[model samples]
Target chain A: MPENSAGTLAPPPAAKPKIKPPRRFAGTLYRGREGMWSWVLHRITGIAIYFFLLVHILDTSIVRISPQAYNGVINEYKTPLMGLGELALVIAIGFHALNGLRIILIDFWSVGARHQRLMFVIVILLWIVLVAGFAPRQIMNIILEAQGHGSA
Target chain B: MTTETIPAPRSSYTPPRKRRVNWEKWGWLYMRVSGLFLVVLIFGHLFVNLVSGAGVRAIDFAFVAGKWADPFWMVWDTLMLVLALIHGANGMRTVTNDYAHRPILRKTLLGAILVSTVVLLVLGILVIYTFDPCPSNAIAGTLPAFCKAH
Candidate 1:
């Protein structure tokens, strides 16, 4: 240990202040930047789609057990409630796929890194077009069926 | 034993680099490969079941049974099930690693994902392979129209 001019041991200099990690909630949820939001949305949509796959597989498997059991489940999907759920599933899938493409491009292409934000904008635009093209018709069908004016 | 001698201090400290298995690299590659396949498989699946012929109305027990009867569709569906489940589970694992702060919670979530994925994959495979479109034990009215013809 270094000694003072008086030839006695000097007290150690004050320790440097410890740096604190960012709060978890603030780090994850409060950051509203495009990249952060995109990451959050990707995780949310991925989990949603995974759960949907579980139900879809189980329901489809019902057919092997018995036709009546299968029909009971499939027929329920024709309801307006399930139609809306289907719409949500479609939207989740569309976003996940498009964003996944963007991620792949960013990872593999040198140019993609420079213009990732541009790619994200394009993804949103395409998602809008896809939803616009599909939603109205599906919703209209559900409405008409509910009113007994169309085929179920 | 000799008397302890003071060691000289080193000028600097540096971590030794070691070659380790790059699981993340392989995982990233898998995501891209599986994603491309999924696009084709998923869209083809949707188009056939929802947009072809009578559209959604065409997707009854008979529709599914008819598709499963063909070896091509059986192969298609089985491949889709296996690939999609693995891809989705891997993606979820990445998410859990990123966000699950508690070690136990992370382990629990990952375990649940793995278990559910394996169970569903097995169930899906069994359903595709063992499907009995026209079971003799099926009640008279509940059977598909084609089953009556058989």
Candidate 2:
């Protein structure tokens, strides 16, 4: 017991438990490799595609109103910004679908668990090939349109 | 008479625990099942909208109206909409539970997801069911080309 300024006996100060500082970037998005990275990217692309689906549904549903109204909304998608956005969306979908396949294989196939890392690598490689095949054409179109040499 | 008291025999039957709903397990199952369906639905959707016939340029009000005129397309679109939305919302719920450290934040995120998913589903369903390609009161110039025939 310790005495206060009034000289009355008071409860002794509680022992302070030693708290360790958290490691640098502990429990963060950047902390993991391979499977962890796949998990994080899968969550991210899933969310992105989810939001895209919401917008796509809403936009497509607008055709019920009138043609002009629907076209007015969709015409904005022709811009360079939207073209790039579409490219990103394609990339997201590519990764999500591939990674989802990997996940399915892991869950259902006996040998999938053993080669999950290999599967992840394959997914990434396939994703790169898909994006590489898709993006350049889109980028070229955007650039060509910007330069006023628009291709029909 | 040295009769030894026998210890009571262990109960042969163990009591069953109360059965609670296993929501997580069901949610996991739903993701896989719905995902399998989504692969086919989504790829078909993309193929039609971007590859079939005249491709993306052919997609417009008339195209959608033509497709919806068929009951098969209507059913396909509706099923895709409902399945994908539920799958996505449930997947997001898992993400929120994993990452959202604070209780209030987690609940709020989940609530938002639920409300948005429900609202979108309702809106999509309404659009699918109530769609009229050829409205009587439509402005003549703004109407889809097919509507002109009527």
Candidate 3:
């Protein structure tokens, strides 16, 4: 071999061809993890809200349809079970709003990633506020009504 | 027939793993989990509001008043509201991030989503808490019979 043969050294052997790995389906359709799950919930809830909106509009439209019928439907909303239903709707709107703020931060600015946990905490705290504000009035009314001092 | 001889195998190839963390993984998990919860909340809400009793016909002002008369229902409704809202907002956020490429447009849309959701949530909670099934001095037919005590 020439003294400088190391330079050629058969070009130190050709590098192996790179192989592309198999595809990963982990996060497909936003089903991969927590944040994506939050996104999924958001979309699902949004659609649900829309669906509920249609029902609500039609239900309320009963006012134009017939006062008796409207009163009948409105009365149903006052049931204990239905009262709970309305409460859930309130919380849904709350979560959607707070998480939305978090997402807006992620999309428009870069701060979301740095404060994911904090944002989530804030979301929960706000929900607590919502509950605190609404739950008492409802409960108090219910109690008062049961006590024969109902305020309607 | 003449054929080429096969060559001997060399060393086995091992794949290298990168140290980079994956954010996409987390996003995927979020969608499935949130979606699972939403199914329960949405269906429960529908069943209670539209399907129970005399179907949709049973819902009305007094119907709502009757329901709100219970504290248990109050908490239930509150939970549903918070969960569904958060789920929806987060989902829209994903869509915005994926499609809204421009910074200004993305921020604006996100801002709009945030503002509308908050305003609606506030108004909704207020309505739920402040709901009055019957006001004082209302016509007899206009009020639920129980309002007489007030």
Candidate 4:
């Protein structure tokens, strides 16, 4: 409500400059750094995980056919290729989950917004740790299974 | 008693449709709530199934049967199946809304997602509940230790 020294009150400058359309398309407000990339990662990982969920449900339903049938299909998942695929699956899920938690924190916690970039780094670190813990063990299992030492 | 009079519409007014629930709000809440539960349930699932002894190699018919034989694991899996599927469906719905600009394509994609989510929910629940962890015809050694007379 403060007025200029000259006289009557005047409105402040527009909240933000109006964006002008370019003759041809350029980029967008997506030039935002860490937050933008985290959002992009979240969307991509989410879509990938959703599709995997559909396939996983269908594959698990093979159990309804018969024990032998289920084993026949599931054993294929133990192959080297599928093992690597599973490893990739684990990585995707880890990022989605850890980043998801960061999102929840940012939404619910008062201070979360101030430290969102830091939280993203934490999410990545946690995801890395998660992958590190599981990868070596799963890789070993893959090797053992491929070598025919799967006594299980 | 004096009451404030409300102004009528200056032009023709259409009556509002029955306002009941805000589905978009519900979807937002569902994402956060289900995401929280899935973080715990799915991590536990992975730890048991993948990080445990023998890892994925130990997963076969018997291993699954051994776990499902217990009522607790049965319920755990059922909760996980329902929550995770719905969460993924809702997330995909958001993605579709963002990207599918053509109205018909958007509707079709949304309809497909809805149908698939429902079908999978029914299928998964049926599998979890109706599962017979022990079959009568199974070979003796192939059965889990819990199955009687195996």
Candidate 5:
């Protein structure tokens, strides 16, 4: 036994490779660039919209729940802060919508690789239109009311 | 000893169909383009809502009801709803196509996406427009009298 223990070489210990923190921006969209950022943002907004949708449904159901509570919630929205929240909802919905349209075109195979920029421009323009059209009222309403003048 | 003389080689044959553009080329384009838009739409949305003011605490029922009450917000929201749903559905459609190998399964999934998008869009729009924060027939002490035609 002593001879065998001494003569036989112990099995080589398997090398435990150092595990680096999983690459921070591994395989990010567009090499960790704008496109990647957009992608991450889109997914985040999508999830946000979905959560908002659930809350939205429940809140709307308050019409049946009790008008008092519904009205109370409604009044809460009149504040400047709530107005801003509405604006966010607008922005999220706008992005989701316009980009979604681009996605629709892609699904139909209407736009080709040559027109990626074209389509991107179109979606951006549409988003701009949506935001521009809605944001002013939200902003102005809050501003005017704060200054003691009703938002006309 | 026999010496063999090799014959000259004939011209090579070529297929005529190599010049066609592929459908997938279009699909790839769509992914990039749509992805670009989704970014702005999404981020703008986040900035406006969660970062603009008091953030998440400000969200409430009237907040939504008030927005929808206006035609401007109505149109904005309606557009957003339709677009987001379609973009999402379409995005999902691309993922489905890439993943669903079987022809029948692919078609079925695509069809489902189409149907669901249409249905959801319709329902969502209806909710936006037909929303009655204060119903006329609401129970006593429930509805604000403004809703009742005096």
Candidate 6:
């Protein structure tokens, strides 16, 4: 706070950085614990779902093109490969939705912010239950389709 | 030496624009509100379409036709399409803002997101509403059972 003889404020004592801020695009991964991982996961899942939703609309629009055209396209979804892919899609969607709800609660509910880590655990548990229920059915569906029973 | 003038810290700062409305705040709110609805709507959609009946094998022209034949499902589909596109586009915008520091790249990406969102929204709603589940020209097996009356 010293002023020079010229009555001007003295320059800040040659500022030196104690620590450098992390630079973006340095090809270095910034590490974080649970909260950051959750954010990363949410973004990944969201991007995946967004892409799928776009394609889904395009494919569904095939119905208007012609019934046979739609059926031909939709039938591919029954294949074993697509069946497994659907499982992964469900998992992505499952996590995103559950985590999204957790986020909402954290913002809206008073105690939610206090117990975010706990809420994250519960979200995972519920998602597991959800996927557990759906996975078996999906496996069964794939199995049945493989066995030539398309009505499974 | 000249009286080196030093403007007060934080005094030189000026807002980039006069933001009359907080679009970002509204966008954030939209994400949460629409997300709540999407969870229920999407879960129900998955359960009914993918889990129930014969699973993926059950879907076809007839299957989709059967669902859209009902007004309830049409409304549900319409709502989901509108809400999900906006929510997703807003999310993408946030991501773009976060990482895409280059002005040209950022604007291009945001522009693409907006364009795609609008295109898909219009296309999806049109497809859902203007859909002819039972096309007169549709082959016999392609149409749903109720189409027998047609």
Instruction: Encode model 6's per-residue lDDT on B45-95: one tens digit a residue.
Output: 999988998888888888888899899999999988898888888888888
Residues A45-127 of candidate 4 have per-residue lDDT tens digits of: 88888888888888888777777777878888899999988899889999999988888888899998777888888998898
| Model 4 DockQ class | medium
Cα lDDT tens digits for candidate 5, A1-152: 98678667776567998988875654322446444554555666675665565455445545545556765665565678867877887788777666556555545565543454466678778889979977876687666546655312
Q: Is candidate 2 or candidate 3 better by DockQ?
A: 2
lDDT of 1 by residue, B1-150 (tens): 999987778857778889898998988899998998887888688668654554454466877877877899999999899988999999889988989999999999999988998899889998888889898756666665667668
| Candidate 5, position B134, lDDT | 63
Q: Residue B42 of model 6: what lDDT?
A: 94
Q: Which has the higher DockQ value, candidate number 1 or candidate number 6?
A: 6
DockQ scores for all predicted structures: 0.30, 0.23, 0.07, 0.54, 0.08, 0.53
Question: TM-score of chain A for each candidate?
Answer: 0.75, 0.73, 0.65, 0.78, 0.66, 0.77
Off by over 4 Å in 1: A1-32, A147-152, B1-20, B141-145
TM-scores, one per candidate: 0.78, 0.77, 0.44, 0.82, 0.44, 0.83
Which tens-of-lDDT digit does each residue in B55-145 have in candidate 2?
Answer: 4434556677789888999999999999999999998898899899999999999999999999999999999899997876566555556
Error of 4 at A42 (Å): 1.0
Best by DockQ: 4
* Cα-based lDDT at residue B59, candidate 1: 61
Deviation in angstroms for A104 in model 4? 0.6
Worst 10 residues of 6 chain B by lDDT: B10-19
**lDDT (Cα, 0-100) at A87 in candidate 6:** 99
Prediction 4: B-chain TM-score: 0.83
Task: Compute the DockQ of candidate 1.
Answer: 0.30
Q: Which ten contiguous residues of candidate 1 chain A have the minimum total lDDT?
A: A23-32
